[model samples]
Each structure stands twice: as structure tokens, then as C-alpha cells.
Target: MTIRLVLAGCGNMGYAMLSGWLKSGKLAPSAVLVVEPNAELRDRAVALGCGSAADAGAIPADAVPDLVVIAVKPQVIRDVTAAYKRFGDGRTTFVSIAAGTPSATFEDILGNRAPVVRCMPNTPAAIGKGMMVVFSNPLVSADAKRFVADLLSASGEVATIDDEGLMDAVTAVSGSGPAYIFHFIEALTVAAEKAGLPAATARLLAMQTVYGAASLAAESREDPAMLRKQVTSPNGTTAAALGVLMGDDRLTNLLTQAVEAARLRSIELGK
Candidate 1:
């Protein structure tokens, strides 16, 4: 509760992470200072008992937080981060969740003295079921890396990568992975409806099946391939379905192409 963190945006993602941290007791409300330009968003942060400000300049001069989280849009990141260069003396670590913005952007703005961590988080993070991957620059202390990982875990699973280049792959796999799943749900729902299920039931079956299967896959010790085989019988109904979906690795190849397309787009955007 010592104002150890500065949250530069209080929009949906920022609010979700903040609420998760507070709910899990990973951070106390008094430990955060939220700088949200929008009055409504700032009010939401204030409602949670944290200090709220309209901008970085409004933050108290005496407040030197351990972390400064940038959740603003990537386009405005440079302008937004320029105001906090005073904290770039290697004491405060900068963490960014802006899509397509690299850690180097912060280092460029804050200078070599600043430590930066770039995170790729999926939309599911809003529901505490996200995949959060981070890549930190060399200047980030060992303890700071662990602390950032722990804080991110409040929202969901956390992973770290040594190679920043792999972040493009991360962007494809987890960052954009939710949309893939959502599309699958949409396809499945339509398939169900075509197969004679009511619209509501089709939607329910599609969503619940995906949700339950994902939960099982997550909890089971067996790998996904093994789990897939467990429910498939020789020339049975599941096998019949698998024949259409997995014949000649059709689904696998299709997904590979999709992921590659996304990875390439991510690389292009980063530049």
C-alpha cells in the first residue's frame, strides 16, 4: 500500500489487470496510482480506492513507484512514455502491454538506463484466463523480472522468453489465439445448426464443448495427442468425425498456415 506502481491507463485491459491484482491480494489498492485521462475510467480506478490522476504530470513529485505500466494505445506510447523519463534512472521498470510495440521503443524514449518488459496478452486476460508472455531487456534486474511475472500471474498463466524475436510467434499463438478459438466456436455452432440442433442449443453446444475440452486438456497429465486418441475408437463415431477433420492432417496444416500468416503480420507490424 505504498504506491509501488503507476498504471498509465485504466481502460478495459488495465482495469481487468488491476482488479485481478487487488482481488488476488497480489497488490493492495493503496499501492497503485492510476493515470487515466478519461474521467469515467479515472473514476472507476478511484472507486477501487487507488489514487487517480489525469496524466503523468499530475502524479505526486514525491511518488517514485517500483513499476510503471503502460497500457495506452501503441500509437501514443512514445508521447505517453516521454513524460516519465525521470523514472528511467534504472529504479523503476517500464512494462508495456501495447500490441506490436517492442521493448526497444521504451528504451529509445527512456534511454539505456531504463529497464523495459514487453508483454503479449490475449483478450481472455479480461476474464482471468489469459496467456501472458513477457520479454524483458537486459537492464531489467532478476528480481524485477520475477516480480513482473508474479504480478502478471494474477490475470492468468505467465511465460518468459529470452529471445525477443520469438515474440512475433507469441503474438501469433497466444495474442491472437483467442480469435481463432472464437472463430472455431462460430464454425461449430453453424455446423451444429445445420445438423438439426436449435440455434440456441447449437451455440450452447459449441461454446460448452470448447470450454470443457479446453479445461480437460489443461488439467489432464496426458498430452493433447494422447487425449485425442483416448476418446477415438476404431471406425466409431469419434473416428468418423476425426476422419473428416484430421484426414491427411488437414486441420493441422490449415492451422499451421493460419499461424504463419499471423506471425508474418506480427513481424510486419513490429517494424
Candidate 2:
């Protein structure tokens, strides 16, 4: 069956997912309707061989998309969802990647019968290395769930949860986790500069090191703690750094606080 996807935003994440779908042959470019109000972004989608619409009204009247992926901000999710009510019948399944917004919100807008999937995707999705997590309402079909998973897999690793409440932690870990990694990269770059390395070289080293370490961990599939131990020879330089980062549970305590703060913020946003 042909999959007609109505992507309701063209921001970085949306565009990235679209590019991945096209590149991976997961979704045909011809079946995608890029619903973006911004002229530049809509044009970018058109350039990639998909149909572009400035608003829901601009979409072809006869078009009943199999899936409507909402990538808008949490603040405007209600309005954007309301605008697409024409497809609220049981035939179309809705997928939202807006953090903090629950599937209940969409069901409330589209009617209780609507099948909504709430998703949290990190920014690394832009590079096709993101963590995409989703939770679907009971009304969602097995086929729809699989289809949505296939679409999201183009972005990166995709996982699902049975409890929607856990989405807050998901938001903190993967959704906000990229920003944490980026901040770490910045901090590492600065430290390298202070250690006598040139600014350009420091930045390159920081970025490459983080990237390589993460890639190795992912491919090795070994426990990260085990990997860290592998790198730390007894009483060596890496061990010295680990002492600072791990001794007294410093890094673990700090990261726990950060993630808790983010999870609380996610809960607040949902309210």
C-alpha cells in the first residue's frame, strides 16, 4: 500500500526526517505533502520532489493521509492539530514529536477515537543518528505502529514504551541529551584551548573524540562502564581523568540532577 504522509512542519527535525525518508527509500518523495507556512522551507521540500502546501487548506481536498506527522512546537500543537481535524476519523493515525505534549492532547482535540502516537526525537536526528522514542494510544493498530516505526527508523534508532508517563524521562534523556553532549563538546574544546592547543585544533579534537567514542560504544554494544574501564589503564592518564569525573560520584550526581530538572520541566510543559 502506498503511504501518504502529511508532515506538518519543516523545521530542522522535520526536514531532517524528510531527507532521511527520501534517502533511505522508506517513503516515496511523491507521496509526501510538506505542510509548512514558511516559503523557504516549503520550497526546500518541493526541491526534493514532494508536494508543498502553505497550510492545511492548501492540501488537495481529496487527500486523506495514512499518517500525519506533527513536528510543530508544543505551544502550537493544539491549533495545528485542530486545523487537521478533517482526517480525525479512524483511518488516519497521528504521530507527534513535540516533547511534553501527550497523546491525550491530540485525542482531546481530534476526538477520543483518534489514534495518536506521541514521540520524542533528539536533534541528532538531523545527522541520522538520533534516538526516536514513541508511545501509542490503545486505538492504534499493529500495522500503523509498524509503519510509523519504519518511517522513524530512517532518522536513527527507534524504540517504543508502553507507558506514556515515561515520556518525560525520554524527553530529558534523548530529547535534551543532545544539548548536553553539545555543551560537553564546547567545554572540552575550551579546556583543550586552555591546555595550549590552538582553537581550531582544540575544536577538531573535541568533536572527533566525542564522535569516535560514541560510535565505538554503539558498534561495540558493550556496557559503557566496561568500555570506560577498558580505556582506563591502572594509575594512568585516563584513570586520572576518571577520578575527577567519577570519584565521589560527582559526574553521576550532577547528571542525575540535570536529567531530573529536565524531566520536571517536561511534566510542567504537559500541564
Candidate 3:
């Protein structure tokens, strides 16, 4: 099916998805309509050759989009959602990338019968290496889920959860996970500097190591644990470092605690 997308909000995530969808040839520039109140952002979309409207009401009244993607922040979602309620005609499946906002929130605004998919995507989506995790309401049809997944794959890896409750964990692991990786890189760079490397050299080493290791893990069929072991020989420097990181599974326990904290915060936000 030719999925005509009506994208609401053209902020960072929205623009990234639009770019990926277009660049990946998943969606034609002409097939997508951008609805953004911000003139600057809306103009960016139009510059990409998409149809733009200042508001949902401004969209041609006869237009019927297969998917209406809401990429606005959670705080203003309520105010923005009502404007597009007219499109909740069972044919259109609404997809939201708004964090901390539940599907029920959209149902409350767009009608309980509306088909909505709640998705969590990280900042990496801006560069097309994002992790997009989604959960759909029972009302959504099989074909609609498949269609939305196909579009989402343009951004990065697309995963679905059968239990909506697991979304909180997904949010903790992949949604807030990028920040953790960034912080790790920062810490590693600082450590390298303290170990006597110049600032620039330390920074480059830290980033390149992380990038190369992650790339290897992604492409290799071997488990990350196996790869780490492969690099660590008995009484070697890597083994020395592994001893510090794995002593009593210290790093594992710390990470588990961190993920739990994030998971609880995500649960609180949804409430």
C-alpha cells in the first residue's frame, strides 16, 4: 500500500525521521505532508519537497493519510492532538514518537476507538543509527503494524513489544541508553587524559575505540562476552582491566541499578 504520511511537529526527531524516510527511499518526498506550526521547521520540510500546513485544520479537508505521525513533546501532546481528531476515522493509524505519553492519552483525545502506536526513539535517530521501539494498541490491525514497522526501519532498528508494560523497560534500556553511552565516552576520555595522553589524542582514542568496538559487536556473530574474552589473555593488561570491571560483577550490578532507576522514572512519567 502507498502510505501517505501526515507528519505533525518538525522538531529534531521529526526532521530526522523525515530525512531517513526520504533518503532511504522508503517514502517519497511528495507522499509526505509536513504539519508544523514553527515556520522555520515547516519550511525545512517543504524545502525537502513535502507538502506543508501550518496546522492540522489547514491540511486539505479531503486529504486522507494512512499514517499521522505525532512527533511533538509529551507536554504539549494533548493540545496538539485534538486538532487532528478529524482524521481518526478508522482508516488512519496514528503513530506517536512522544516519550512518556501513553497510547491511552491519544485515545482519550482522538476517541477510544482510534488505532494508535506508541513509539520510543533515541537521539541517534537524527543520524539514522537510532533504536526505535514501539507498542501498539489491540485495536491496530496486523497490516497497519507491518506498514508502520517498514517506515520506521528507515530510521534504524525497529522492534515491537507484545506487552505494552514492557515499554517502560524499553525506555530505560534504549531510550535513555544513548545518554549513558555518551557519558561513558566522556568518562573514558577523562581517564585517558589522566593517564598522560594529550586532550585531543585522548578524545580521539576514546571515541574511536567505542565506535570500532560497537561496530565489531554489531557485525560479528560472536557474543559480546565472547569478544571481550577473546581480547583478554590470562594476566594481560585487558585481563587486568577486566578484573577491575568484573570484580564481583561490579559493573553488571551497577548497570542493573542504573537501568532500574531509569525504568522507575519512566514508569512515573507515564503516570
lDDT of 1: 0.93
Number of the top TM-score candidate? 1
TM-score of 3: 0.97
Residue-level lDDT tens digits of model 3 in 140-171:
99999998999888888999898888988999
Scanning candidate 3 in windows of ten residues, the lowest lDDT window is: 1-10
RMSD (Å) of each candidate, 1 decimal:
1.0, 1.4, 1.5
Model 1: lDDT of residue 10:
92
Off by over 4 Å in 1: none
Better of 1 and 2 by lDDT: 1
Model 3, stretches more than 4 Å misplaced?
1-3
| Per-residue accuracy of model 2 over 1-271 as CA lDDT, tens digit each | 2439999999888999999999999888999999999999999999999998999998777778889999998899998989999889888999998989988889889997788998899888888888999999999999999999998898899999999999999999999998999999999999999999999999999999999999899899789999999999999999999899999999999999999999999999999
Residue 185's lDDT in candidate 1:
100
Clashes of each: 0, 0, 0
Cα lDDT listed for each candidate: 0.93, 0.92, 0.91
List clashing residue pairs in candidate 2.
none
